[model samples]
Target: MTLTAFLKDRLVYIMTFLFLAGFAILLFVLENYRYPGLIESGTMVYIAVFAVFLLIIWLAADYVRQRHFYRQLQEATERAGERDGAAIVNNGVTHEQKLVVALLQEQNAAFLNELNQYKRQQELRNHFVLQWVHYMKTPVSVIDMQMQEVLRELPLGEEAQREAAQSIQEEAERMTRGLEQMLHTARLDKFALDLHIRRRPLHEILRSAVNSHKRLCIKHSIFPRIDGEAWVESDEKWITFVLNQLIGNSIKYSKTKPGSKNLQFRIKEQNGGAVTLEVEDEGIGILPHDLPRIFDPFFTGENGRSSGESTGMGLYLAKEVCSRLGHSLTAESVPGKGAVFTLTFKPGGIHVME
Candidate 1:
């Protein structure tokens, strides 16, 4: 049934009933009167007119009261809609309505206060963490230089010497990665990760990163290959860092027989000026469950496969860098086969890295 039709019908029935009741009462009073001189014809007419006028005045007052109540309800609804969980109480209200508004106001104030407090605490914590990481770098560098000197002076069988050098290198690299992770995590939310961005050839950055890992690649027998001729517009330093991390992880995880080359870096161009770089490995593949969480901070999944000494932040940092550079990074893996890390970079638009 239509709302208008229902309201019209109900109003008509109610008004008719009210009028009939008023007329019936008037007739009853007139009939009960036995005074021939008490109520003269002129007095009766005056009383009848006064009674009808009084009934009309009462009905008008009742209608106005009901309309005012409905208007107040509508205004309150609109005011509530404009707010964000905040509430206000006007000058006049019943006890229950006042109590509800007061409770909501208290909750809103408490929530705001708590949020402010949390932000302050987090800022202080990040400041301290960043300072600590910076201070520790000097000592870490000193230890690495000292360790290199010690290995240089030691005499041993070829096998023993190689093993010892590898151990020292792994430890030093692990320390460096940890420092980067600590610094990155502390500053992740505060500022953009890109410190320097410019127009640079992808091959130049890739070459530099690979050259830096020459010794490790040679020692592990992981042959790294690069393909594609596309140049990207982004922060060279950060992009290079991301490439190094992915390439390094692939080299570290590959299970090729000792002294066998098993790493590949392939870049391809797609439609719409998009570039794709895939770093594939012949090492231990990530499990299906662990693949999704690989890019998450502090996620070292299913053995320390990502690194010989995984700090669990290389992939996370790389993901963040790619996002800040308007790119996307994804992984595909088959357990016991290998893993492939694909980086999709497009011109113009920052990647939303989490």
Candidate 2:
């Protein structure tokens, strides 16, 4: 590509030419073989002049040809770097250069094909997960219904029977929640397509989420109290899901404590029309090291391991859903006091459908 480098590549030829010229000069100067007419021969001078002219012409043409090929190669490499499957520029390409370009193009095509195949496989896996969760829900629902019927038919004075029935119902509820988490986790990859955002009353969404877990809350002696009101711009369904996860965690962790359990929900309007919804629970709070990584998927910390009921996906999914909905989620906790999860909705954060 450079003149110095090009000349270095032809160093052998230059050296051979120089050696032949030196041999001819040595033969001409040798007294025993020298002809008397050699010095006076103008033909020898003409031959020397012609050979020099040819050498100059050959070097100039070679340089121009090599420079052209290298320029095209450089341009093709740049284009390939910018985009996959870019066509190599082949103008004025030598035979060897054409073969190299063809090889590079074939490799690029193969790489792109492989990348697309990987994406397809990932999509298929997610689809299968969603389908499996849906199918499993049918059987879970049937079991819950059968249990409810059995519970109702039991005699009124049978406390032991009622307790056993309630335990079964609780286990069934846990399964349902786990299934829902899986379903949502699978759908997270396609969250953009499923999102519907609008301005909705915060209290209504919170109440709906709380009611969904009413039985569990009563079982754990965890009382929920919602105070204050503000309309938030968010996806109602996703926000409810987020609330459910938070409330569920609160009830779960607080149930082990001795004191009266309380879960409080509050909404406050900030300056510039932003709203913050907080869920505070009187549960054993997060450990210092685990608090920061609580939202990481499948990262169950000390409390989760102790409870033996954490999938570690709930908070992770809640955080992701909030992010997609253009809201912020945060948490604060003291070791044994409690943990408060906050969702902040900024002004004009949610897109309202017409």
* Clash statistics: count for each candidate: 3, 0
Across 174-279, the per-residue lDDT of candidate 2 in tens digits comes to: 8999988888888888888888877789988888889999997887788899999999877887888888889889998999998578899999999989999999
TM-score of 2: 0.76
How much lDDT does each candidate structure score?
Answer: 0.72, 0.84
Give the per-residue lDDT digits (tens) of candidate 1, residues 81-148: 55442543432245664666677668768877898899999999998998999998888888778777
lDDT at position 291, candidate 1? 89
Best by lDDT: 2
TM-score of each: 0.69, 0.76
Output the number of the TM-score-best candidate: 2
- Stretches of candidate 1 exceeding 4 Å from the true structure: 1-99, 151-166, 193-195, 255-259, 296-299, 303-313, 351-354
